[model samples]
Target chain A: MTRIYNFSAGPSMLPEAVLRRAGEDILDWGGSGMSVMEMSHRGKHFGAIAERAEADLRELLAIPPEYKVLFLQGGATAQFAMVPMNLLRDRTAACYVDTGIWSGKAMEEASRYCQVGVAATAKAGGFTTVPPRSEWRIDSEAAYLHYTSNETINGVEFQDVPDSAGLPLVCDMSSNILSRPVDVSRFGLIYAGAQKNMGPAGITVVIVREDLIGKTIPGTPTVFDYKKHADNGSMLNTPPTYIWYLLGLVLDWLKQQGGVAGIEAQNIRKAQKLYAAIDASAFYSNPIDPAFRSRMNVPFRLADAGLEKIFAAEAAGHGLVALEGHRSVGGLRASIYNAMPEAGVDALIAFMADFERRYG
Target chain B: MTRIYNFSAGPSMLPEAVLRRAGEDILDWGGSGMSVMEMSHRGKHFGAIAERAEADLRELLAIPPEYKVLFLQGGATAQFAMVPMNLLRDRTAACYVDTGIWSGKAMEEASRYCQVGVAATAKAGGFTTVPPRSEWRIDSEAAYLHYTSNETINGVEFQDVPDSAGLPLVCDMSSNILSRPVDVSRFGLIYAGAQKNMGPAGITVVIVREDLIGKTIPGTPTVFDYKKHADNGSMLNTPPTYIWYLLGLVLDWLKQQGGVAGIEAQNIRKAQKLYAAIDASAFYSNPIDPAFRSRMNVPFRLADAGLEKIFAAEAAGHGLVALEGHRSVGGLRASIYNAMPEAGVDALIAFMADFERRYG
Candidate 1:
């Protein structure tokens, strides 16, 4: 069977080893006589799976004792509202940095629950750069300061954690959580959709400092409350059991790859090679500032916009797929996440050089 | 390779055929180089899968043209809040029929948003039966009348839909949605988690009348609003792609098993035989009224309550697992969902008879 190099942003490619192990375990997990999908969330088999996933994640990220890790549903979009709902304890507003479409969506959703303040924005530069920390307006009265570490659509990323101006820092790390190591203590809360660097869709991972929970706004749904989920071990309801199991498999595979530090080194190498190829070519141009270009999603434009479709179509023919950019922005994007091998990037680079030779 | 019978209430057994197919497709789906989990929600491959899933489900249940089917994240627990958040448009109260724990939870959540009037309740009878329709006092002015079609924990189920008393009817069919045929036109909205009769644990299916959407409460998150999801075809954000594909597989398998009506016959025969066996034995008793006993979950008690634990342990040793009841209620429960074959049920009966001969 020929497997392709898939570059779809989220719900993207997973480690081949994880998929192989998952397929083998589909009918009977660890000889339990029941598929992971069939086991009850409360059952001992799944209980062990859940515990190991959390423990491995804690070790990988070095999460502290004061932090509670929650596996929730509704994706990061749900967190857009949940953040304001659970964190806006007696506060009138929250601060958000507008990096791209994702952060903008988060700001809009939070507006429904509380006053949303745009402390910093990259919109003036066409969402190609992050507004520097020095330019950010500090709103100390706001409940927390929020930012998207990586903008999957715009290909903009924060090089380092920005000071939250003394407000508790919250981050949307959906597209880049495990691609690199981070200081968890710098943020009050970090939320991510598991579809990217973790596993598949359906599960959202939330790591929050314990002190920030329990003060949900009056109208928050119990399921949306951090305290309820944390108190119940994310079993306030029957969680996505199979998805949780798959996440566990991915975590196990991540550990085999020498953990986050090991994967992060490879991630940097892959991004640099691809970016260097784009910079060397007159036929291709990436618009984002060199300093803020995302290592996860690299969006670029062909010198002739008409050739962008042909470039993507030909790439798929070579078993390199999903190279098209976001529909909102018509271009070509290659999202090289942790699961993307360096060989895939090298192949894409080789194909680009050949295409340039013919079209240039 | 010893595939045993699993009787989990939800996140229960899946059709072995479905599991086999899922296992095979985990690497490459439909000869595509990428697995379904790797496909973007917007891509043509997953687009076909998603459309066909909705179409097959529509045919299976004979859903009307006016009903919009949504595959969402968060289970029925999320629906408990979403039902009131979206349906309580400009209305200050809603009517709820409290039959068991699930219904009680739904009512408690709804009360957080609006006035919840208990139209009828089986609590007076220890939740052993459904309150007669004649006794229901559904408020005409309330936004909707809500009920639980089957309670997974308490093992109580309604044999037929009750009169809504001139209000839009909302039903949580989480545990027994596809086990039988039902007239969908009668309900304003019906929601079910996919773990029991459908597929796995991450996706929630919402079949809502077209007119019931587009009017959410003031602070409802965009993802929580049915209108937003329905508008985007449940792609308001990246959906649980792999889980949706698995649900599609379950729907396909259900069709092969002769759709809902065919399964309904099997469900009846299985439930009847099990109930008959329980009734014929003086040593075992099901506390739920026979008329309201669930076809999905059969909860029973031993004459010698001390033997309950021993009974469950022995049953597991005989290739029957998860026979222990919910922690909230202490006894034995066999959740024979649609996927639990008749052979499995027959085996269970034989085991029960043997156990009684030795212990009775």
Candidate 2:
């Protein structure tokens, strides 16, 4: 079978090495005679696996000891509700920076729990830019400020971490986590859905500062309570064991790629190649401001909308899959996560050039 | 390596054939270059996988046309809250039967959203017997009646479906789903966590009546909203794709095992042999009433309680792993699901007899 590069916004491409290792161990993890999926969550084997996976993730992200990592279900979408349920207390409002689909979703869910103030919005710019830090309207009485570090749908990214003043800074890093090195100590909490650059869709990784724990509303479900998850080491409910195992393999692969620094260089170069290719041709255009263009998830449009189908079909023929943009924003989106090799970006660029030549 | 029989309450054993087939196909599913975990939820490959998985599940369960099958996350733990959120519709009261740890947890979470009336309790019977239906004090005006058909932790099950009398009858069938046949028409809704007889954790199977659709309160998160999941065909969010794939394999295995009816017979024989061994000896004792002993999860205590550690360690030495009972219940729980062969149960019985002779 011909090799293919998947550019899905989430549930995107994973390193082939991780895939191979996961396949080899799917049925009998470490000769335990049971698939990771079948092992008891409390079994010593899975217990060790879960701890090691979290430890490796901590090392990969340079997470501080004060931060508790939770392996939660329901993805980042669930966190949108959980964040407010856990953090939106003793405050008049929580601030949200609306960049794209995910941030808007966060705000919508938070509104159900507390007053959600729009601290900033690039919506006026058609979501083609991240609002400048100076333009933010943060509330002095805000419980916490929430933002998305990278927007998958609109291909917009906050190039710099916002100054939250005295409030805790929280971010949905779903589409951008592990694409580059990050200072974990700078934020109060960071959550990422695993499907983008981490591992799979079943698990969400939540890193929260220790001081932020133990404040859930009385009615919050146990699984959604960060305090409960941290207290039980993320096995409060039978966690997604197989996904945790797969993520461990990805973390190992990341280490082999010389850690986050090495992968970041490749991700930057790959995104640069695709964006450069799009910029070099009038037939294709990426609308996001260059200053805020995402290193992962580059959404672009063809000059002639009529050729969108042809571009997608021809790309698929060349082993480039899932390059279709999110339906919320109709165009093409190339998600160059850590696993998307430079070679894949080169292939996409080559395909884009050939398509332009044929259609222009 | 000695083959081990896993008696974990959940995150339990799967069909060996299913695990083998899953291992073979983990990296490249049906010639697709990507692992099912890496496929986009909206892509044709995964879309077809999800659709077929649901269709096969509905067929296996004999789900009525009026019931909408939803694949959700967060396990039955989350469903405890979701059940009240979507079904109670701000009603102040609902009726819940307290049978074991699982039912107690359901009530605990449901209490957050509504006034949960304890309709019946098996605790007085040492949590081994199901409350007689005639003694149930279900509030006539409650929004719905909730029960756990099979309690994994306590090894109790309600053999007969309760009459709803125009009220919705919701059940948490987490441990016993797909193990035996049931009348789907009797239930207003049924939700099962996939760790037991289904496939893996992270995916929940929700079969809701068509009338129970779209009643979620305004604050309900989109992921937990039954209406949202039903409207989008359970693709409201990126589901646990690999888990769904494994579940499909399990459904295929169930069909080959003569569907639910065939598996039910095997389960009956397995439970009967194990229970008979315990009852035939003064060395072993099961506290549960014989009439309500679960055919799936058989929890038995020893005549000499001081020998619990010795019994557990000896069993582990023999490769009968995860036989330790739930900490809350403090006894040995042998969860003999559809995957546990009669030979495995016989092995357990033989081991128990030998252990009793040595330790008694």
Candidate 3:
């Protein structure tokens, strides 16, 4: 069976090993005589699976005891509202940095719950760069300072954590989480959809500092309340059991790849080579500022906009696919997350050189 | 591989055929060179998978044209809040029929959004029966009349839809949605978690009348708003793509089993035989009213209450597992959802007879 190099951002390609393990365990997981999908979330078999997944994630990120790791549903979009709902805690507003589409969406959702302040924005720079931390306006009265570490659509990323200026720091780390390690203690809450670096779609991972929970705004659904989920071990309701199992498999595979540090080295190499290839070609141009270019999603444009579709179509024919950029911005994008192998990038670079020779 | 009969209430047994198909497609789906998990929600490959799944479901239930089907996240627990958030509209109150645990939970959540009036309740009868329709006091001024079609934990199910007193009927069909056909046209909204009769855990299905959406409460998150999801075809954000595909597989398998009508016959036979066995035995008893007994979940008790644990353990030893009842009520339960084959039920009956011979 031929498995192509898939580049669709979020719900992107998983480690082949994880898929193989899942396929093997789909019918009967480890002699339990039940598929992971069929096992009760409260059953001992799944209980062990859930515990190990959380333990491995904690070890990989070095999460502190003061934080609670929750496997929730409704994705980061749910968390967009949940963050303000649970964190607002008698506060009137929260600060957000507008990096690109994702962060803008988060800001808009949060506005429904509380007054949202744009402390820093890259919109003036066409979303190609992150607004400098020095230029951010700190709002002391704000409940928390929020940002998207990487913008999947705009291909912009923060090189380092921005100072929250004493406010609790919250982050939407959907695309770049686990591609590298970060101090978990720095953030009050970090939420991500599992469709990206974690595993697949359906399950969302939320790591929140304990003190920030328990104060959901009135009328918040109990399921949307962090304290309820945290108190219940994220099983406040029957979690997406099979997806959680698959995410556990991905975590197991990640550990085999030398953990986050090991994957980070590969991720850096893959991004650097792909960026260099685009820089060397006159036919292709990436618009993001070099300092802020996302290592996860690399969006680029063909010199002739008309050929973008052809470039993507031909790339798919060569067993490479999902190279088209976000619909909002018409271009080509290659998302090289942790699961994307360096060989995939090398092959893409080679294909680009050949395409340039023919079309230049 | 010894495939045991798993009787989990939800996140319960899936059709073995569906599991086999999923295992086969886990690596490469339909020659797409990507696992269904890897396909972007917007990509054509998954777009087709999503559309066909919805079409098949629509066909199976014979859903009317005015209703929109949404595959959502966060299970029925999320729906408990979303139902009131979206359907309350400009009304300040809604009527709820409290049948059992699930219905009670739905009522508690709805109370957070609006004035919740109990139209009827089975609690007075120890939740062993559905309140007669003649006793129901559904308020004409209330926005809607909500009820649980079946209680997975309480093992209570309504034999027929109750009169909504002309109010829009809203039902939570989580545990028994596809076990039988229902007149979808009668409901303003019907929601179910995919774990039991549909497929697996992770995705929630909402079948809502078009007129019921687009009027969410002031602070409802966009993802929680049915209008936003229905507008985007449940692609408001990346859905649990792989789980959706698996649900499609279950729907495909259900069609092969003769759609809902065919399965309803099997479900009826299974429930009747099991209940008959319980009724004939002096050592076992099911407290739920005969008419209200759930076809999906059967909860029973041992004459010697202390033997309940021993009974469940022995059942597991005989290739039957998860026979223990909900922690709240504590006895024994066998959730024979649509996927639970007739042979499995026969085996369970034989095992029960043998156990009684040994211990009675």
Highest-lDDT candidate: 1
Q: What lDDT does candidate 1 reach at residue B310?
A: 93
* C-alpha DockQ of every model: 0.87, 0.69, 0.87
User: Can you tell me which runs of candidate 3 are displaced by over 4 Å?
Assistant: none
lDDT of 1 by residue, A266-356 (tens): 9999999999999998899999999999999999999999999999999999989999999999899999999998999999999999999
Q: Interface Cα RMSD for candidate 1?
A: 0.7
Candidate fnat values, all: 0.82, 0.68, 0.85
Quality of model 2 by C-alpha lDDT: 0.87
In candidate 2 the C-alpha lDDT for residue A247 amounts to 86
- Backbone N/Cα/C clashes per model: 0, 0, 0
Model 2 misplacement above 4 A? none
Better of 2 and 3 by DockQ: 3
Per-residue CA lDDT of candidate 3, range B1-360, in tens? 999998889898888999999989988998999999988899999999999999999999999999999999999999999998999898999999999999999999999999999999889788999888888887788999999999999999988988888999999999889889899998999999999998889999999999888998888888888999999999999999989999999999999999999999999999999999999999999999898899999999999999999999999999999999999999999999999989899999999999999999
The docking category that best describes candidate 3 is high
Q: Candidate 1 chain A: worst 10 consecutive residues by lDDT?
A: A130-139
- Residue-level lDDT tens digits of model 3 in A19-133: 9999898899999999999989898999999999999999999999999999999899999999999999999999999999999999999998889999998898799998778
